[model samples]
Target chain A: MSQVKTLALVTGGSRGFGVAICEQLAKKVENIDFSLYARSQQGLESTEKLIKQIKPSANVNLFVADFGDIASLQSVWSQSLKKVNFSEYQRVWLFNNHGSLGPITNVSEYVFNSFLIFIDMDQDHLSNFKEIESEITLNVTSVFVTSSLFLKEIKSVSTPIETSVINTSSLAAIQPFDTWGIYCVGKAAREMLLSVITAECKDTPNIKTLNWSPGAMGTDMNKEILVKTKDEGSKQFWEDMIKNNKLVDPNFSAGKMIDLLISNTYTSAAHIDVADA
Target chain B: MSQVKTLALVTGGSRGFGVAICEQLAKKVENIDFSLYARSQQGLESTEKLIKQIKPSANVNLFVADFGDIASLQSVWSQSLKKVNFSEYQRVWLFNNHGSLGPITNVSEYVFNSFLIFIDMDQDHLSNFKEIESEITLNVTSVFVTSSLFLKEIKSVSTPIETSVINTSSLAAIQPFDTWGIYCVGKAAREMLLSVITAECKDTPNIKTLNWSPGAMGTDMNKEILVKTKDEGSKQFWEDMIKNNKLVDPNFSAGKMIDLLISNTYTSAAHIDVADA
Candidate 1:
């Protein structure tokens, strides 16, 4: 591998794990250059300030974009690359850590009512159907757009060494939740996409595409899902499930991810589940 | 398992494979009824006409609504269910086959050769980083929103047997092509969704879900992709491979699907790779 400093791009870097990913990349990778993508301009600026505070000489830049919109990703990614002098960097580490969780109440009510009625199912309704469609778009389609754009870049770059594409998938990618059909489906597709990348870019040894399930983290997305459902009884239940069995702190997860980036042991362009990692 | 006629709701049943699914159901199962969904009034009429022509006494009702639109699905599904007299039907089979294939192009061309390059990677055009975002709403977001709503119905339904959701995913769902990122990502997420269903509903056997890859049929979508990509330089490769390997026709493939559905032998709510099937 070349000895050029690694360049890192962290999406959803405005808060939570994204911030952690940015910080860790700056500290771990020597001569690191960073581009942080997030929706909020203020968040982006704040993140940049923090990066600069940590390493005044770090070539840190902020790009505001919404993963929900394909255009934002297209613009943000393209603009970010425009500033890079790739010759200076030996390896590139792309960390896609942004995602949203929502539409949580559609199932708990069904489960509760079914428990009461002793009926296995609820009467059919259409409103919930539409919500699922929206969620799939926000969760899945956006990932495709972003990944597709990024992968294209990885393939085209004239770099001599290796480049890694790390997608932020979820354990939920393999497992489903009660009302999280939309989210689950999106993540599942992402896993398949990693497989596809594995097959398509089999010859592209210089590029390692992977969907990394950072496991569950105590992020806003986790809290958001809880708030959407408004379930007091199951709050502790979910928290316990995460704390006891599922959730991993963002910093710990980010550190592990940085290790994976440096380890370079994953030879196939397939998704690496964190539980297994 | 119930002797009562099976009730199937075929979204986008006006024509194409959706109509084919309806016809196949009528011929294969006795006393089967279909609630057909389509946005086009003429398409619905055509489906009804075809159903009447095929089986003079087949009980087929038309529900007019855009499956791509969330609110439309809600209104159409609810109103249509009310009219159907739910007591009459025993088990529900939701064949979600309605969808569209969006633009095919690399991220650069789609976004005007912008965002195609990342910072430090393409410093030549660093000053002109601002580029227009892709118009992804109509082609991608619409399907996601509607599917999300449909999933809600799947979660909420109270039928004796869990509703069967067979999403019409594509080979693209597993792989990314130059111009089909939007469609691929949307379907990819849905694939994960079924996994989610499998994990969450392990105890609940009523709902049978499959992220089906209906092998590359000579459908309109395939034709469009082939035409757009000039056969993607792999048509001959696939055709030659299939001919040499004696690949089965789509009709035969559909037969295997019907067999799987009726026999219920393949019970795991796992992703049944159509290629494998």
Candidate 2:
């Protein structure tokens, strides 16, 4: 009997939510292979150590890459996949959980009036629209490009029943946030993009796409956004106005991420809002 | 007699559709002054020539600057408006109609990806997304940031009526096109960005946003994508169809753009599809 091929690749896996995803998938899933991508080798090692602590024999590989770099992203599928035998995997799941929050200043302060700042922004953001552009490219564009690039390798594999994608979007995907303009726009686009991908792969039964809006979590992003606030300010502010009561523990969020992938409950082409679910 | 401010300020007035819009407005309205923006000094002179040809005493002034360069864009606005005397202008209309088109190829083929190219793509051509990402940037990031930048400026103006923004989008804004994925995705984001802008500015009635999709036209971008012969091609044979009366002239399309703006029939927060109109 052919060994089942079950592989999972998570971007931005070095720290925070991504690292948690690595640990959860390894501990919860059976006979799984994993590939996690991040910008630094040191960070990848930390995630690898955590995964190994959970599952001694977990087939977890680390890929060092900047998700924003086109060449690096292309390599994630081409050079990185060559190291693993995809044919042995019965299912392939990719989790794009990486992002960068751009500058907090009002964009108009510099963009339209400063030639220098505008050029610097375009160069620094990697051709992405300011806050929203970078967020979308990192969160959404990478998933689309990486999946399309490796369709050939994926199709060649016979054992995998189907390939599944779980995109980590935000509640902001549907509702626009005040300072989180780009973040909201990018997530919204991701929802539609998942719809587009599902439509493209409609004929292929083995492929599934999901737009998962992970409600607020105790992640580094939130910690940073809500810094300098006491329990009263933090708790009351989010609970009262921000409506951040749905904040889940990182491990719990990771478990939920894995559950969505493992469960056959995901109808193809569905926009799964974690809050709604 | 107080000189009335023209209802719209069109960027890239030297050639293409910008000049056409000025001509249309000049003929359609009375007592409306025009403020045109372009990068080239020669082009600005030519625009003045054309305006004078239509109406010898027409109130038209050229604001020279490169929009792609944000600082220049600012200088143009500040200097151009200085000459206008804001008290005379009641309503401000901004048409962001300038962009550059890049090559269409696989993402791997180009040294630098052109995700900004969506601002310049013709709607009919479908694109390999990875390639398009490499070539396009403006749509993913520039369009929204720039739009917001303009909105920020117009909001401060004491113009009693309202400021309306007409964003130039493509049919690809609604659906995907070949060799135009990056562009399509960018434009789609542009539409939503405007939606966000409108929603964000709901309290401020003076600011209005519209996303208009102009159908395929005989513009330079379209001409390049047209198939020399539509007959037997395995894939990418839309040009042949154009030769067989499948394509439409862009001038007629511009008429639709003008009509949308002038008719005021379309509301501020609407995403209007010209082909459907």
Q: TM-scores, in order shown?
A: 0.79, 0.77
Q: How many pairs collide in each candidate, listed in order?
A: 46, 33
lDDT of 1 at B156: 49
RMSD of each: 6.3, 6.5
The true-versus-predicted C-alpha distance at residue A224 of model 1, in Å, is: 3.4
lDDT of 2 by residue, A155-184 (tens): 556654568766787776666544455666
Q: Alpha-carbon error at A84 in model 1, in Å? A: 3.0
DockQ of each candidate, alpha-carbon based: 0.28, 0.21
Writing each residue's lDDT as its tens digit, candidate 1 over A1-277 gives 3356778878888998898788777666667788888889999888888888777778877888877655456566666777776657678777767777755544323213224444633433223444444454455555555665666565656766467767788766766666665566666766665555555554667766677777767877777755655446567766786668667777777777788888888755556665677
RMSD after Cα superposition, model 2? 6.5
Q: Model 2 - which docking category?
A: incorrect
